[model samples]
Target chain A: MSSALVYALTGAALFVLGMAGLILQPHLLRKILAFNIMGSGIFLMLVGVAQRAGTPDPVPQAMVLTGIVVAIAATALALALARQLLDMNGEMRLPEEKTGKDRLDV
Target chain B: MRTLLNVTVLFLASAFGLALGWLILDLPVAAVRLPEQVTAQLEMSGVVHPVTAVLLNFRGYDTLLEIAVLLLALLGILALPRHVSDHQHRPSSANPVLQTLTRVLAPLMLLVAGYVLWAGAHRPGGAFQAGAVLAGAGVLLHLAGLLPAWATPGRTLRAGLAVGLLVFIAVAVALMAQGTLLQYPLSWAGALILMIEASLTLSLGLILAGLYLVLTDSGVQK
Candidate 1:
């Protein structure tokens, strides 16, 4: 009903979307993008929920700022790892897992 | 089978989203009023801007560790095995217009970064924003072929990269002599925050720019 609630709901949807992409996307870069999207969703939820009373809250905003920096650092590290994989294997996707009965150890 | 998995995942995701949305809607009003507390202590926190005060003062520890994390990421990238690509080594031949534009814009960007860093004390700007601007300038310079991709960081560059964190730790340690970690005396809070922010701006700029620089093909070349 409120603007803050709207933002929070949108963030929840983004988190779900990102989670799905993280599971289904084979490309490491895409997975990283998904991870970032998930992080953004969390940040949005954090600030939005904290400000649900419509008052500006500095703590969550500051936390989100810190989160943004950390997210970028994590993303950079992930990208570097992915780039190394691409250099070595000539592709960015991980080897597909054997599914169904073949995936079962027994 | 794949279709079944997709259907299950889609169904689960939607369910999760609905639950989360419902939970948000149901959340009771928070008992703690952090904004009021921040406002009450804003003068003591050493900055006019509440977010800036919270970042560099109330929750300074997070920012301190954040800089370290950024430096560590750069280190990880640097430690990756070197792969010299001949094509990467070839000098970038940028468009003359872009080059000219970069030459004109880089100085202005530096000025803006400085302004943003100084403005953080009273406004929305802060070290992170300022450093990001600086990093943007570096990326632009590289794109224009005005700056070379970093190979192994030399001694000076390494020092510059570590200086912000070092300064922050030093300040924390210095403050510890008087009280607990990072507890600045009321008199020195403003100056101390500014001093720390100035160094952080430089180091954050270097570290953030290094994130992009070291990942480039030319940077990977030994």
Candidate 2:
């Protein structure tokens, strides 16, 4: 209803969407992108709540700022690992994919 | 069976989403819980921007560790084995449009980065934003084939990568010697913050661009 609530709801929806993607996507890179989307959802929620009082909270804002940088660092590391995997196998699927352990059919 | 998993995922996601929507709707909207504390110490923190004060003054140790993490990521990227194709080290060709855009935009990005770094004391910009901008400029020049053949040249690159962490540690050690850790002298907080931020911006930009360069270099087809 309120703009803050709207944004927060949208963030929650994004988190769910990302999580679903993470679970469903078979490609390693897609999983990483889904993880990022999930992270962005959490960030959006933080920023949204900070504005709930009609004025922003600077502490959460600073934390979100730090979170963004840390997210990039982690993403870069993940990407490097993914690239290494691709080099080794010439394909982007996880090892678990071959093992069928990634499947939830059980 | 395939349809069953999809249905399960959608149903579970929707349930969780509903719970979150309820939580958001119920949380008190008018509570100015944290800003009061920030405002009380605003004058003493030496920055008009409360976020900067929190980041560089009150919670500086967090930032120090953050820089360390970034450096660690660069180190990790550097440690990865290079493929044989990587040895070619040829610059990717850029079209005339990209070359001209890089020429015009790179300088402007640098200027904007400096402005953002300086403005953090009183505004929304800070070292993080400035550093990202600087990294963006590097990526642009890199894409345009204007950067050096090697993304990093030996010791200078290593030193630049580690300088921000070193400076941050130096400041903390200096403070610890005076019976405090990461506690900048109140009178010199602004100057100290600016000095630290300048070093951090350089290292972060280098680390980010280095990461990108490594990602591109490992013979991965872009």
Candidate 3:
């Protein structure tokens, strides 16, 4: 297999891992981290799949650069919201997910 | 029940992974050869680097919208209600070693950011990367207590935050008088792109750093 294909496969695995983490973990911070991981996986997949034919494609590379910037902005926004929640409620968790001992799972 | 839910989700996620991997493996060679096309139009696109050309010329609208999105994110953070206990206080100065390191390193980082911004025309650097570096320097200064967490930004700071998008939109609207939106004339493309990138670098730096600074002073952490 080509190196790009390997990267793509790893990205797939990472996406799944991130998805699992996003679902299973109750902490807002961990959820944010998982969301970032999922974004990275998507970025990797995009570039890897595009370059899988052995030629560097500037289009996908540029897109990935754009994606990175957007991801960071999204992350920052999420963190701000989480921080706001923490300030108001004294915890960084969704109201729905706060069920007993697992609420303090972090 | 939580364990059962977790197990089921894990199993489904694993299955999804397998499917995604299979789909990736099955992806046929792309019919369109974008690199060749990008190379062919490289001269007209104004920048020697293909990625920069695509980012600021061919796909300039995307970058324009991206700056808007970034600004919106900062605005969203600013819109959040301020905690009453959150005061305009500076973090205590860190260890002398860290402070000294920040003093030495911040200027160097700014220099690097400038170089990167200039180099995007022909190399693997650009406004986004440069802006990120600039923000990193700001974070470092804040961490070392050379800079304080932001309260409300002042007029000059606010103007700086908006300048990039303003310049970008002005350019786009000006170009629209001649033809379609963001379609730069071949003769003016390089200079226009550089101007835009410079403004973008400044604004992006502020916005990115604001994302951090606006949160730190919130007294959120336990």
Best by lDDT: 3
Candidate 1 structure quality by residue, lDDT tens digits, B85-129: 657554455589989999999999999999999999999999999
lDDT of each: 0.88, 0.83, 0.90
After TM-score superposition, what is the CA distance of residue B24 in candidate 2 from its true location, in Å?
1.9
DockQ of each: 0.56, 0.60, 0.79
Cα error, candidate 1, residue B112 (Å)? 0.4
What residue pairs clash in candidate 2, if any at all? none
lDDT of 2 by residue, B33-87 (tens): 7888888998888789999999988889889999999988877876876544546
Model 1 alpha-carbon miss at residue B39, Å: 0.7
DockQ measured for candidate 1: 0.56
Once fitted onto the true fold, the runs of candidate 2 whose alpha carbons sit more than 4 angstroms away are A99-106, B28-32, B84-94, B149-153, B218-222
Q: Kindly indicate the candidate among 1 and 3 with the higher DockQ.
A: 3
Name the top DockQ candidate.
3
Candidate 2 chain A: minimum summed lDDT over ten consecutive residues — where?
A97-106
Better of 2 and 3 by DockQ: 3
Ranking by TM-score: 3, 1, 2
Residues A1-106 of candidate 1 have per-residue lDDT tens digits of 7798888989999999999878766668889999999999999999899988988799999999989988998999999888788788877777673333322121
lDDT tens per residue, model 2, A1-106: 5586677788888999999988877788888889999998898888887787677788888988898899899999998888788889977877777654445422
In terms of lDDT, the poorest run of 10 residues in model 2 chain B is: B213-222
